[model samples]
Target: MSFARNFIGLGGLLSLAAQAQGAYTIQDTYDATNFFDGFEFFNYPDPTLGFVQYVDAVTANATGLAGYANDGIYLGVDYETQNPAAGRASVRLVSKQSYTRGLIITDIAHMPAPVCGSWPAFWTVGPNWPHSGEIDIIEGVNLQDSTSVTLHTASGCSFSQDSWSPQDCGTPGDGSQGCGASTDNTQTFGAGFNEIGGGVYALQWTSDALRVFFFPRGSVPADIDAGNPDPSTWGNPTASFSGGNCDIDSNFANHQIIFDTTFCGVWAGRVFGDDPTCAAKATSCEEYVGNNPADFQDVYWLVNYVKVFGEDGGFKRSIAKPFNA
Candidate 1:
């Protein structure tokens, strides 16, 4: 059902799976020239839409997305004095409609989780938050090496993770209402998140479950290319999201993927200097600052591409290759 074409061990491999029902193809590929068009805005500071600013920072597009080095879109944030909340920023896509059932796939070059006050995430939220469940597919805190996937709901919702690594923790509300942590190698998720090519993240949502999966650079199949994709064959959805947990499926309509690098504040900031664990490091949260101010204008996130696929009735989503080919 799939094949690979090796070109001097340099070019990426390609894999194709025979369609179980209808034809499948690539729906959209966010390249450098067109990547900015799909996103409404980047790195703008506004709390209403969840944007935070710092004094020192740097952000730019990396080349991995464009198949060239340092040429794709990237957003980096570095703060020296710490802000209200981690110097956070976010953007929205599909503002009018909520996509309850679809496949959201992206080639992310990096989602940094490097410092004590660093909180990096790729997640989705409904029109209004809290009431409409929030699905955090990839998230991590300071010193966390593995990514944490959690859902925030009002009630009548429970989650179970069937991952290769031992899953841990469960609390409720705003992530502080007794939430727990999963026992996975947090660094495995961050170690090479940006350096060794980056990783591919896929979030599949259906009436029955919300699933997530991560594919490392060399491990991804060739057929999952921007030119063509077959969701059924990209490996199981990373996480199986369920609907029995408070109509979360309905709450996540018209959601968007967000990439943010927030600094010490509220959640992560509180842990600094006060938390015994942090004090033991002999490095106060302030020690992380290395001449760079809160808004240094040097940090950023590089995204390869973001692709969305609307399910066509069954367990499959068919994407047609654009004629631009």
Candidate 2:
């Protein structure tokens, strides 16, 4: 279950209506004060082969690609000039500390607009990738209007759902399309999300299962803002993956929180022509994403905060650097 997708986005809403898991204490918060320091800028090539340039921390902050706006962390991309070399300039952040199981709550003010040639996500991944595991808390490609929560893992790692589940966690078709479900609520992503001033996306990962929930701005649970989160009161999750046939412990290890906006790649680019809007813009996805630079002016992330709540701070991933150099 990698980055690729069919892009249909709409699926049945199978809910379990389980109870609130439990209360959680905040262990870490990433807001303007410590956002940059808490995460490392991925200055490497796009692993998905997207049309993007992952810049370093110095360049991102100094060049205005990453900064703070109204006390919110702002991560944006270049929107000037046409078709530059090395793809569009963007930012990808990986949390310095990783966790095994925890409740992550992200309060977003705005996400990238629902525009063609853009793929954005707020997710988590184990250090070793496929063999480890990946949970897509919020993700979509092209002009998708809502969120798609999915799980990707190595072979023989599959999970069950309340109603009916997708296939195993391994790749089903040509590539990995990890079993997942969509929120189908327009207010949960893209333009609609920004119009309502964005809200909260919470990911609850426990040994028994992984669940994702979305609360629109005015509808966020009171407990969340009060520093106490009770998932049981949040109603059915937008997407839930049961640990039935999967080995949650062995398949998922210390995972780092991630947020990024990438263009035409394995997912978006592969199905470029499949999307009428994007296809009509240009013959290829790269051409439009590269030449129509102004089209991406609104491609950005406005985060109020990201709080991780867990006992023992969840499973901490050991690393040499306490902070990103």
Candidate 3:
């Protein structure tokens, strides 16, 4: 349980003033050995009821669906199984700890490619589904080269056109499509992401707003590498979700981080008709995924580290208090 405390001073008065505003301090880190300990394998049926089998840690390790590799966490899907009955076997993990407000930074070395019938995501969700809200930080389906960030909540949440697709953060039946922001950079997702050797993804959640930023491998800031991240100095985020219409505090709470890769269920299956490339492969997402086992050979996640930070240098180490109040 060693902590890295490296604070940079900006000269006398300014440094003191900066401290008054609050600074990000490292709270918890999950890597290789510790990463598996921090998260629990999700063996239950997928919430979306996707055509996939979520295996436990024992099965994951035995089947080579999950393990440690190159000093990082490796989570992959079954590539050897041919046309199976249930579905393609995969791994889904959810953090045992939950956070209310903090900065979550994930450094990934590789991610699953945007192959047909494949859907991968690194996101967070609170207890009780739509009532507590869900944040789709990195999510895309089929052959999408760019990542799409979305926020889903109950009624009465809305956002301006700040993102690429500014939709209401409310239920679809309520006339809102949910707040969605698609990244313009191709290197931010899929095969392009792995081509650049992956990178760091930082998500800052506060009472005011939720911001997400992506820094490609070579471009990651030195401060992050030093374990002294300062989001203020990181410049504009790739996606910013904030406005007077949305009540940030009420809409989001006690969210647990999650990582999973599933074959076409709701999103990918529903939109299978739209993707020409994917549609040409098979009549449906499940059909394509069930038959073409080799297509997902490169589908996996290689994570270097996941670090959590709190504001004002206030971080609690107790597992009981996963988040700072």
lDDT of each: 0.49, 0.78, 0.79
| Candidate 1 runs further than 4 Å off | 1-28, 42-69, 78-98, 160-188, 243-245, 273-299, 313-325
Q: What C-alpha root-mean-square deviation, in Å, does candidate 3 show against the real structure?
A: 8.3
- Tens digits of lDDT, candidate 3, 175-285: 224678777799999988888889999999887788999999999988888877888899889998877588888888878888999989888888987999989989988
Stretches off by above 4 angstroms in model 2 are: 1-22, 172-175, 312-325
Tens digit per residue, CA lDDT, model 2, 6-111: 1121122222122333556566778866777677788788888999998887787767778777667788888895897899999998887777787889999888
The residue-by-residue lDDT of candidate 1 on 71-127, one tens digit each, is: 455544433434334433322222112345567777766566455555567776554
| TM-score, cand. 3 vs. native | 0.88
Candidate 2's error at 321, in angstroms? 7.9
Question: TM-score of every model?
Answer: 0.66, 0.88, 0.88
